[model samples]
Target: MDLIQRFLFEDLDVRGALVQLGPVWRQIQRNRDYPPAVRSLLGEMAAVTAIIAGNLKTPGRITFQLSGHGAVSLLVIDCSETLNLRGFAKSEGPIVGNSISELLGDGRLLLSLDVEGMQQPYQSYVPLEGETIAAVFEHYLQQSEQAPAALFLAADGDNAAGLFLQKLPAADEKDADGWRRVHGLAQTVTPGELLSLDASVLLQRLFHEETLRVFEPKPVRHDYPPDREKISATLRALGREEIESLLADHGEVVVSDDLSNHEYRFSADEARALFDTPPPNLH
Candidate 1:
């Protein structure tokens, strides 16, 4: 199981989020054989999503999207307020890079928030400006949120993990020294350390001198859309002639593109069953 833990600095006006993902990450990677670089990047981004979305106050979802003219064309990860997550990547050729810039040449990263009651969702975009995913996230927080923040992220193809720290707006001159000390101490954390240690051990090791208030952790799960709704939507999108031709000639209808990671195959009877089911929730 995967879990995210929230914590607060008792008197320094700082907050943090720590995430450790194991099964959830493996499940996502199991669906596709991502390249070494792509797999690492995706895992990092997924952990980042859990850290950010876990802090959301509204009932909604956050999506991280990256696109560029490089070996990898598109990558997207969606995390709901409840901590349900799903993600995938699309590439045109071999993806080779140890960092965001090398992998996504001239790429842009977009963060979109879809709040349930808002008339329209809010979005922000930034040029991929850093050597690592953690640096990119740190830049975004400083630029868009006008807050002093730091991110520590790591992944090993099998599991992913991350830690986020932010100085709250309420911090004053008295807390300035503490802020510096905290950041300085956090710098010692390595990618290997983040991926291997439990949240309690990692946080205590990093902030043993600071007064901290830790909250209970919550579980994060992998959620897939209902098969009935997904199947019906694909069947309805096809013209009658096309559907008939697929059934008569191919014996099954394929719903996804050739470049997609997975294909949805359905027989004529299975397609009909999809239509008989109730419609999925519009919201």
Candidate 2:
């Protein structure tokens, strides 16, 4: 089972989270058949998304999107506050380069948080400034949160994992050098260890001397249920003429939700029924 665990330094003003994904990661790629380079990049993003989603204080969803003009044109991952995830990647053609910059040439990262009761989702943009996804997120945390952070991420055919460490605003008073010491210890972790070791064992190995408080692990899963009402509303907005044209060309109007890996198909009779009543005023 995929899970995420939160931990804190008992004496120092720092917090951290660890996420390990196995079945969920495999499920995400089961239908996509992404290239090896693209798969690895998406897996890393999946891990990062889980960690961020797990920290949400309210009921909502978070989306991470990477877009550019390279071989891999777009990568998107959506994770709900409950850690339910669904994502997909789009490529222009064959992928060549392995680095983030090469795979996503001139790409920018966009993070959107849609919290409950908010009129609009809060969003932020981060430059693809690092070679690895971990580094990119670390830079984002530093810039957006105004706090130093250490992030390590890794993924393979079987699993994906991440380790995060951040300095609290009041960390300087609790332990003048706490953030430095903890960050240094975290740097010693290897990708192999992060992927294979249990959260307890890994934490002990990295910070054996620090007093730590570990929380219960929370489950994460890949769940994208069909939103029929939303899809119907979308077709209604497309207007009767467009829907009729689509049905005429293909004998049916088929709309695909890539993220959910599901399709909505409306036949001639069904499509006509949608317009039996006047469509809502989109304006």
Candidate 3:
């Protein structure tokens, strides 16, 4: 299971978080042959997205995306409130010398909140100059969530982990001290601790004196994409013309009553069935 935990320091009025990912990290890399640089970016972004998703107030999905003129034009990550997340990026150019900024170009990092067509999602575009995923998100929180936040994100070839601390909104001016204390302690977290230690141990190590109320570790599962009806809408949105064009570009296209085809083509209907039913055990 993906190890994601949330903790709070009730007296200090600050919140802390930790997300340790490994098996899932390997899974993300399995389907795509991403270069070292791109994989690194994905690892960092994945951890950040997972941690932020865990803290989101909604139970639907949150997406962190980057698009524009860049080597990698897109980074799409879907974060479920259940902490089930899956993400991938599109490489617009060669993988050579690709940094996250170089990949995203002069793009804006758009953090979109999709609540399953419930409420209007929250969106904030931060300039891609964050250089690091952590920095960009810190800026986003200040501008969007109206909170000062810090993130410690690290990734190896096969594992990704993240830690987060944020100042809770308060009515008094004394919160500065609490924020400083937490922030200073947070600075001590090494990459090893972030990726290896349990959330409770990490919190205690960071804020030994502060009274921290730890919450139960929440279970995070992986969610497949939309269901059949939704996928039909998606496919229908493409219009019969587009579908025909796709078939013409190659061969014939068939819309089956049931989603079972023995080919490597885009079968939206079949793909949609994954969500209508439960996903096979990721384990």
Candidate 4:
């Protein structure tokens, strides 16, 4: 497993995190052909979400999903507390987007926080500025919420990386000398640096003089939703009528086959989840 580390400053009491994705980058590419602009956005989103997961406290998944009208219809970054991330994008052919506002037009971004143990999830929708993801996030902090957050992200073919900084409420507002100094230092982080440096090295390079405390690394893992058995049970839940209708309409949905059986069927897992009782656990 590749390393991702989180650190903090003892004297400054400021928290920081670092994450690098090389192998995971390939997994994302397996789904479809994504244009350069779309790929870059997803890359940045993945990196930022990883950092966000590291900083926030949660056992479940946090999703940064963007959907709107434009060349790029959708972009999703699903990140868990452990750092297992996988996602895909929907776009309209080859489209070059310089900013979120230009790409999404009149658009909005949805930040969904889903916990497996919880019944109700948390979500916030911030209007898209047609600017870069970085700019949109800045607006999200100032408008949607009160916390002032900054994000710097970059991506290459094999790796995606980001640095996120948010100022916490300090006891002394005007007297807080470290705040401005830290922010200025953070501003020195270039896109190339974010994509290149590892966590420890990056922090040391950025804040060499500050007293920093490094935290124990959290193991990151991934989960693939819904297995084949679950898929069949879900297909059966369409009351058989709908399933038959679909079969008639679209013929067989072939997943795979052996020498003897065709093993093809319609998929209705999503519909089942929305309408019918879930199948018994096969575990």
Each model's C-alpha lDDT? 0.82, 0.88, 0.71, 0.68
Ranked by lDDT, the better of candidates 1 and 4 is 1
lDDT rank, highest first?
A: 2, 1, 3, 4
Q: Which pairs of residues have clashing backbones in candidate 2?
A: none
How many clashes does each candidate structure show, in the order listed? 0, 0, 0, 6
**What digit string (tens of lDDT, one per residue) describes model 4 on residues 1-283?**
2345776655554555666777676666654567778888878777777777666655677888788888888888787766777776778855865677666667778988888778877998877763787777667655744666667778767788766666565613533676667768888998778777777778899989887778876655444543566556656655767765665666654443221112445445544343465566666
Q: Model 3 over residues 108-208: C-alpha lDDT tens digits? A: 88877878766688786768667777787788777778888898888777788888888887712545578887788888888788777776677778889
**For candidate 3, what is the lDDT?**
0.71
What TM-score do all the candidates reach, one by one? 0.87, 0.88, 0.77, 0.80
Query: How many clashes in candidate 2?
Result: 0
Model 1 lDDT vs. the true structure?
A: 0.82
What range of 10 consecutive residues in model 3 has the weakest lDDT sum?
256-265
Q: Residues 1-283, candidate 1, lDDT per residue (tens digit)?
A: 3999999997888889999999888877765878888877788888988988988766688998888787877788888889988888777676676777677788889989999888888998988878878888788878977899999888878789998999988765548687788888888998888888888999999999999999999899986633645656767666566677778987777776322234677888876555566657877
Q: Quote the positional error of residue 177 for candidate 4 in Å.
A: 3.4
Per-residue lDDT value at 272 in model 4: 37
Deviation (Å) of 176 in candidate 3 = 4.9
Preferred candidate (TM-score higher): 2 or 4:
2
lDDT for 215 (candidate 1) = 98
Measured by lDDT, the strongest candidate is 2
